[model samples]
Target: MRPREASALDALPALPRDDDGPVFAEPWQASAFAMTLALSERGVFSWAEWVDTFSGELKRAAEAGTPDDGSRYYHHWLAALERLIAEKGLADPAILVDARDAWDRAAKATPHGKPIGLSPDDLARIRDAG
Candidate 1:
């Protein structure tokens, strides 16, 4: 791993890590983890900012009676990322919402076990909405 990535993981004590690296239960979890580190390295937010947002997400999920299973951990991470991005004015919240809807549509349309690629119309719709 790159030094920056190593430092990022080192800073994230709550995250599960081993000699191999941070362990992720699923592909999307890994994507979310990488996105947060990349954004922090770009100076979009501090690692502390991520931790603060993520902690709040975890707390809220717990209060809402969500199970504390490892399965839903990354779901909370993604929520925190979205919240932080919007709160920091890094991206328009509406754009995120539109992109999410577009991706959901694309995923549902794609076949099981096949890669989901967004169609031109999906891109156009998000762009138009923005």
Candidate 2:
């Protein structure tokens, strides 16, 4: 994935939650969703094309007896993203690997304990500085 895509995915948990719950209840789903949006926004594919591809993938998965649970759905999304990236020559696999590693490190460094030490904005600035 591109760095912006990864960052977008990483930001999902911090976004205000929708009534259905969090917009992304799972990490992989967030990643997949961000990737789809990023690719579409970048003009690599149209939104209609993305919907069609997702529908096709869902149908194939159903035929294989795997219903469209979130994880499987995201897996399909990731596969589609990978295919598009490859077809468009957007970035090589090595770049994606590096991006993933950077994202993972950032995710890990995020505070998980009780809020302390600073206001949210201040903490964010501190993290950004680091």
Candidate 3:
């Protein structure tokens, strides 16, 4: 693993990994992981803060009756990343909500097996390049 990823994993001991590196079951999971690492590297939030927020998310999920069977690790990860982004004012929380809603609308509009395409206006509302 690269030095940064190694350091990230060191700080995130809960992360699932193997001999190669962190294991992600989905592409979006990897995106969420990378985005968190990038944000931390840029000093948007300290890794300690990330850990605390992520731990809180996991705790919340468990309290809500979700089991920590590793199936939803990335779900908590993404939730934590979203909370941090909103807490830091990097992006408006409403924009994220709107984006999610827009994606749902677009997906419902799209036919089966084809790509889900959002409207230009919805796409324009996206602030992050990622």
Candidate 4:
């Protein structure tokens, strides 16, 4: 993943899962979906355009013989997000740098050695803070 895209993922909170369920649950996907929504709301790209680009990327990847694996799907999503940011020149490298630094600081500061994972509520707070 690109540095900024990785930073964005790192900024998100961990997804809670049910005890008797698959590892990936609604919460995890929702976290990713929320990131997409937040980025769109910030004018990085329109929702329709973002969906189109990501869908196209997935199709291209499948055509290129990459299996439809979970990792590959997430990678494609990250790549698409990176491309969108680059195409619009919406998120500055400096801004990403700051985010990266803040993420590092937050990770270090979190209690119980938990990485800085934001809940949906936390995301809302961050959005409002900005």
Candidate 5:
């Protein structure tokens, strides 16, 4: 990883990191972490901007009476990322919502341990809705 990406990892202090790497409770959590670094490195947003957004997210959850436990930290991270992506106009928010719903449907339909795959029809539905 580049120096900037390495610094991005510092933004995630809640996650347990060792010489190997940061540990995640789930695969999707790691995927979200990777996406944040990739987008930051691509100039989608500055690391400082991410810190502000993520900080606000954490504060919001606390104000809403959510526990400070680390279990939901990644959910807030994802919310911050989605907010930033929309705020930056990098992607259409409606398209993102549509894609998320499609994925929800696909995941719901898939059996446990099976890789969730979106059918062509699902893409067509998402595109049409978007």
Candidate 6:
């Protein structure tokens, strides 16, 4: 992590973490955190904006009766990232949906215990959409 970005992340209040820093129950949770950090480093949005949007997502989810046991934390993280990127006109919600579908197809096509790789058709659909 860049020094500046690391410090900015350190400043976030109420982050779910231990002494080792952010605790993720799944690999995708780690990925979501890293992706959000990368986007923020690239100036997609400020940390302040991220905090606000993420808090809103958590708040809304709580109000909607989602679990508070941290199982759904990264779900809200991904949702917030998508909303922020779309709000900034940096990404299209539909294209994101298409990419997600493509990923699902790729995962379904992969054999058990093998790395998931996108098929040519999946790649084509993604590139075409972009």
In terms of lDDT, which candidate is stronger, 4 or 6? 6
In candidate 5, stretches whose alpha carbon ends up further than 4 angstroms from where it belongs are 1-22, 108-113, 124-130
Estimated TM-score for each candidate: 0.68, 0.50, 0.69, 0.49, 0.71, 0.75
What are the per-residue Cα lDDT tens digits for candidate 6 across 9-116? 677556454465557877988999999999999988999999999999999998998866666879999999888988999867787887788788879888889998
Q: How accurate locally, in lDDT, is each candidate?
A: 0.86, 0.68, 0.87, 0.70, 0.86, 0.85
Q: Can you give the lDDT of residue 10 in candidate 1?
A: 71
> What's model 5's lDDT at 72?
87
Report how far residue 60 has shifted in candidate 1, in Å. 2.2
What digit string (tens of lDDT, one per residue) describes model 5 on residues 2-109? 565457767764744346545897888988999999999999899999999999999999999987667688999999998898899877877877788889989999
Model 1 sits at a Cα RMSD from the real structure of 11.9
Instruction: lDDT for model 6, please.
Output: 0.85
Query: What lDDT, from 0 to 1, does candidate 5 have?
Result: 0.86
lDDT of 4 by residue, 34-109 (tens): 7888988987678999989899889989898886655456678877776777777866656566566666666766
| Clashes per candidate, residues 3 or more apart or on different chains | 0, 0, 0, 2, 0, 0
Alpha-carbon error at 76 in model 5, in Å? 1.3
Q: What ranking of all candidate models by TM-score puts the best one first?
A: 6, 5, 3, 1, 2, 4
Clashes by residue pair, model 4: 13-117, 13-118
What lDDT score goes with residue 115 in model 4? 55
Could you tell me the lDDT of residue 31 within candidate 6?
A: 90
The weakest ten consecutive residues by lDDT in model 2 span: 114-123
Q: Candidate 2 local accuracy as lDDT? A: 0.68
Off by over 4 Å in 2: 1-19, 69-71, 93-130
TM-score of 1: 0.68
Model 1 residue pairs with clashes? none
Worst 10 residues of 1 by lDDT: 12-21
